[model samples]
Target: MSQKKMLRFSTGALLLLLPWFGGLVLGEISNDFSQCLDFFYNTTPPVGITAAGYQPICQRYKNQYHFASLYNRQSRSPLYSAYVLSPADGKRPRSTWMFEPQLAFSRASSEMQRFQTPLDQNVIESQAVLEDYKNSNFTKGHLNPSQHQKTVEDRKATFTLTNIVPQKAGSNSGPWNGLESEVLNRFKAFCNGSMHVITGAMPYESEPRWINNRVSVPEYMWSAYCCPSYRSDLPEFLKPFFPTYAAVGRNDRNSGEEIVPVNAKAGASVRGYDVRRMSLEALEGILKQRLGMPITLFHGQCQ
Candidate 1:
């Protein structure tokens, strides 16, 4: 064939295969979704797992005796806390932590998809029903720190379903959020690598609230610990960001009482707390049974 004819034939073939090739590439990337947390469910494997599957990075551990809350509520679920003890990567201690590595949380939005069970979506979506539970008092809490996962990709990963709970706005975005930022900043200042962090939500008091057909109630508060600190490759100017943080549940709007226990563990020369250890399978089971419905995940500020 003439050179011109050969070139034309090659172009035609490429165009013909473009759809298949493009789809394959897209699938491959989507399949690479690996960072995930698990919950418990009676079903063998919970819903919304990626094609890559879910894996456990933390161990199941709890310590109500020594644990502190970022926010406090007069709810049974408020005091209970859980964490994952991630492997120390040479920089951080192998202490019990909450939140998982590379995980982040934000309020639900249309753009993000719900990764938990189908039941979560139904339960969480009812604004009017949940309103009584939400009460405009709580903040959509996030477990992952943005400073740790600076990149958009990693930050986006934190938006998964398993990493969120309702928190008082004063607690969620205030001191508790401040702690996450300070920890990451400190890790970045003194440590040598990326900090592996785990965060969790402590449930809060529930009013007989109903929002948009959803029985909305603040179920969890905040508790986070980090390990294997961050890279010390920070500019000196940013050093101001590394101050120590204290956890306190914010004062209640209605009662005006110091509801949250700020500095809950202050002046305590304690080394660390024990963590709950569970496999990915076990976590998934819990998520399925507990969450039960699908819930949306996202990043950034949301009302």
Candidate 2:
């Protein structure tokens, strides 16, 4: 074909495909972390995850950034959410779940917004929404659990679907939840300065799993923390846990017993969903294997 004819054909094909993969276009949640870098250990994101699928989101709510979420639009989930572990008072807020409007419209708004009645088609296509979890046999798991936030608004900001992944109920309310509580206990007991925590999901190796054909379900839930400063007089047992800590929880009962082994002695409700605590290096090695790249969760390994 002639050069002009080939150019015309290519342009036409692209125009037709635009609507099919409209959500792939990055709207407004941008590369800039200038708005909320304090959430990271040294105001630096984890190194080595340089794939196009991941986008940095400074989760803003009510005019302030409460945390940061490294979102994966293709997976319709967060790679991880980072925040300082603050004392959560009162109860889980009953606020409506929200989404990043910029994900749908480039100039819509920087702040997260609540899903509208019959949520906009663009919004629904751009990211996971409330309907994706309705009766999907999976729970909307929060990477940055509200219990770790300090204020009501900070806690409520975590309800955004961008920071969520489809997690099994067995894990959400079982071993994983227990791990969250344990981390809080540790923070309250020893951490003197800011205790930064990063929680994320791990996908199955062989094949992808999805809920509502829109959201990817995680195979394991992992978390790690860094406390730069703590009490000088530490107990013997807590020595190894100081400076940094890490863990991985089984999200699927049928999953292989390689990363996180199942506890046969556990109650029937949470049989295979056991969480295994490990060192920072151990967790990073696993992440490197799973993500096919090196990872540095905390700066200088929380030195």
Estimate the Cα RMSD of every predicted model relative to the unseen true structure.
16.4, 7.2
Candidate 2: tens digits of C-alpha lDDT, residues 1-303: 999999999999888545433333234467766678899998877887867878788887777889999888898889899999998987999957998887776655667877777676888888999999999989889999999998999999999999899988999998899999999999999999999999999988789999988788889999999998999999999988989999999989999998988889999999999999999999999999998879999888999
lDDT per residue for candidate 1 within 111-211, as digits (tens), equals 22323222333323321112333445444444543334433433443333233345555555555555655555455446553222334432234343322
Q: Each prediction's Cα lDDT score? A: 0.32, 0.88
Off by over 4 Å in 2: 1-28
Tell me, by TM-score, which candidate is best: 2
Model 2 is weakest, by summed lDDT over 10 consecutive residues, at 19-28
Q: Which stretches of candidate 1 lie over 4 Å from their true place?
A: 1-137, 160-162, 205-220, 228-303
lDDT of 1 at 30: 19
TM per candidate comes to 0.37, 0.90
Once model 1 is optimally superposed onto the true structure by TM-score, how far is the C-alpha of residue 244 displaced, in angstroms? 13
192: Cα error in model 1, Å = 2.4
